[model samples]
Target: MNSPGTVHDWVFDAIGTRWTVTTPSPLSRPVLDEVRAEIDRIDLAWSRFRDDSTVAEMARAAGRYPIEESDQPLVDWYRRLYSLTRGAVSPLVGQTLADAGYDADYSLRPAPQVSGVPAWDEVIAGHDGTLELREAALLDVGAAGKGFAADRVAEIVARVTDDFVVDAGGDMVVSPRTRPLRVALEHPMDPTKAIGVVTLDGGAICASASNRRVWADWHHIVDPRTASPVREVLATWVIAPSAMEADGLATALFFTPAAFLRGDFDHHAQGFHHVTIRRNGSVEHTAIPGLELFL
Candidate 1:
C-alpha cells in the first residue's frame, strides 16, 4: 500500500543520462531492473548513436521495417509534431546531428560540417504497419525516446502502485493521473539556478535545451529548414497528457515561436503548457486557464 509519506527510489545511467524513478511503494529491485532492461531494449530500436539500433539499420538500408502496434503512438506523435512545426521538428535529422560531431560516442568533438535533414514527407508507411525511409538519413529520437521510456516506467509502476515519478533526465511522468507535482525548471544560461517552477497537475513534463549537448556552434537540436542551430530559444519546457508529447513539443518550442503555441492554433490534440528561455536569459511562460507557473 502506498501513502503520501513513502518514496522508494532507483537511479541508473543509460543513453547518456541518469534516470530516476521514485515510487510511493516498494517497486522491488528485480522489477525495476526489468524496467531498465525494457528501456535498454527500446534504445536498441530508437538510438541514433548506436550502430546496431533499428533506426541505424533503417538508415543503412534506407528500407522498410516491421512497425507493430507498439510503435503506433510514437509514429502518430512524430507525424503531428512534424506537421505542427512545419518540418522544423523532424524524425530524420540523424545525419545532421552526427556531422555536427554529436555521433554515438558523444565526445562533444567539433568538425566542419554541412548538415541536412531528409524529407520525412516522402517516407512511406504501409497499411500492414511498416515504415520505409528511402533516403540517406538517420533517425534521432533523442528525448522523445526517453519520454516514451518514462511513460513506460510510469505504466510499470502504475500496474503495482498509483504513486510514482519517472524522471528520465528531464522528461518525467508522474502517476495517479491527478496528483500535482512541483518541478523546478532548470536555467539554461546559468547552470546552478532555476528559471521557474510549475505544478504539473497530471500527466508528463519534459524539458529540452540545446546548450546541454553543444560543441562549438553546433548542438544536438538543429533547425530542419536551414540545417543550422535554432537561435530563438535557449531552452524549453512543455507539459502534456503524455511524456512523449511533452518532450516532442519541448523540442518544437525551441524552433516554434511562443506566439503560435499559444491561442489555440490546433484543437484536435491535448493542450500544451510551455515555458521558454530566450538567449538573453529572459523567460516567458504560457498558461492554459487553470495552469499557473511561478517565476
Candidate 2:
C-alpha cells in the first residue's frame, strides 16, 4: 500500500463513521487532527445519530418554532437530493426508519409506536436559510453524511498536498498524481470477491449496496417514495465531479428506473469513469473518454 514519499494514509473514527485518508505529502500530525475536528463539526451539524445535532434539534423544535438558518446547507442538500431523485431519496425517511424499529441511537432497539411521516414537500424553506415543517418530521442524512465528510476532508487535504484520496466506508474522493487511482468493488454477497475495478483520474466515487449496514433484516437505504426498502438493484456506484453528487446519486440510482439511468448514468460514467456491481455479480462500467491519456 505504500506509494513512496508521495503518499500517506491515516484512519480514525469521526461523525459516527470510520474514515481513511490517503494523501501525497506527509501531512503534519496537527493538520490531521484539524481535519478530524472538521469531520466532527460536519457530523454534529448534520448527524441523525447525535441528539444534539442540528437535525435532531430541528426535529425537536419542529412546530414549536422556525428552524434557524444555521442548517441551510442541510436543507439545500436535501432539497437537491429530493428533486434529483424524483423523491426517491429523502430526509423525511426518519419516520419510516422509526416505524421499522430504528430509534434515537444505533443500539438496535425495537421500534416505538409512531405516526407516519408527512410528505417531503411539507418541509418549506424560507428566503433566508430557515426551514418550516408542516408537521414534526424526522430528518436523516445518513445517505449523504459520509460523502460530504469525505469531500470536506479532501478539501482540507488539498491545501497541504496536490494528491490524495479520502474513503469513508466505500465512498471516496481522489486526487491522483503519479498514477490513476484504482478501486475494487467488493461483492455485496461475498466480500472476498470483487466484481471489478475502476480507475479514477481524479474526483469522487461512491457506492451504495443493499448488503452494507443492515439492521434486523432491513437494509439502511429506504425508498422515500414508498417508505420501503429499495429492492431493484443490489449495488450501484457513481462517479461525479464532487463527492456529494457522487454519494447522493449512488443512493438515488438504487431506486431509479433503468431507462432513466441510460443517459444520465452514462454521462457520469464517461465524465468521471465509474464501475457498478449488481447482486448477481454483473459488472457495468465505462472508461472516461480521454482518460487513457492520463493513465
Candidate 3:
C-alpha cells in the first residue's frame, strides 16, 4: 500500500555505487536535507575509495597496532565474512588482486606485480579494536561495501518513516510497508530479462551476478580456496533480516558448491531464503518450509 501523501524519490552516489531512497510520504525539505546529510556521513566513514575512510586508514595502520574500538564494525564484518566464506573471502586477497594487475588503484598507470595469496589467519583482529597482520596484506571490501551502505542508510530512513527502501547497486533494505514489495532478479548474462521476482516483506534482499566484473575470463568473485574465479554459480540471491547479512550471504553463496545449493542449505540457515541461477540458466530456489514464491 502507498502512503497517504506524495511519494518522494532521492538519488545520490556513495561507496562507488548509486544509492536511491524512496518514501511514500511527502517529507519536509529540512527532513530530506537531514537524511541526505546522514547518507553523506555514512559514505565518508565507510567508503573504500576515500583514503581517509575508516577502512582505508585501518588497512594502512595494519601491523602497526590495532585501531580504536569505534572501528569495530570493520573488524566485525571481517570476522563475519571470514566465518561465512570459511576463509574463502578475505581482505588478505590484496596480493591476489595486485598480481592480477590491480595494484595501487584501478586507474591509468597502475602498478603491476606478482604477489602470493595472503592468508586470512595472518590477519588478526584484537578485541581492543586493533588489526594486525603477520605479513603485508591488502584488504578489499568491494563485496561488502554496498551492503554496509544499505544497512546504514536503512537505519537513517527508519528514523523518519516506516515505509521506505534503500537500494545500493543490487543490494536493498526494505522496511515494513502497507503491501509486499516486489523485487526482480536480473539475468546474469542478459540484463534486459529478469529471471524471477521475489516478494519481500520487511527484510533485505541482495543479488550477486558473475558477469559484471569479468576480466579476460576472470571475475572479481574469486574462490580463495583455489585463488581463482568462482565458475559453478552464475548468480546468487540471499534474503535475510538485514541488508548486511543478505549481502554477505549472496557473495558467500557464489563460492558454495552446487551440491550445497539443494534443499539441505536451509538447515544451515534458519530463516534465510536462497535463489541460485546456474550457468545453464536454470533456477533453483530454497526457502524455509511453507514459504511462498512469487516466481
The numbered model that scores best in TM-score is 1
Candidate 3, residues 1-295: lDDT per residue as tens digits?
5546667778777556777888886566777687677667655655555676655665565565544453466457767667656787676665565456544465322235334555566565342455665544456766665776678678767888888888888799999765777888887878888777778777788988889766664677777667777888898888887777677778877876435433333525444687887777666776533344433
Q: How displaced is residue 224 in candidate 1, in Å?
A: 1.3
The clash count for each model shown is: 0, 1, 4
Q: Which ten residues in a row have the lowest lDDT in candidate 1?
A: 262-271
Error of 1 at 243 (Å): 0.5
| Better TM-score candidate (1, 2) | 1
Q: What is the lDDT of residue 7 in candidate 3?
A: 73
- Candidate 2, residues 182-288, lDDT tens digits: the string is 77777677778776666777888888888876777567788776666766678877778777777777787677644454454444434434455555546555554
Candidate 1, residue 143: lDDT: 38
- Compared with the true structure, all predictions reach lDDT values of 0.75, 0.69, 0.68
Cα deviation at 12, candidate 2, in Å, is: 0.8
- What TM-score, computed on C-alpha atoms, does each candidate reach? 0.88, 0.83, 0.81
Screening candidate 2 with a backbone cut-off below 3 angstroms (N, C-alpha, C), the clashing residue pairs are 6-24
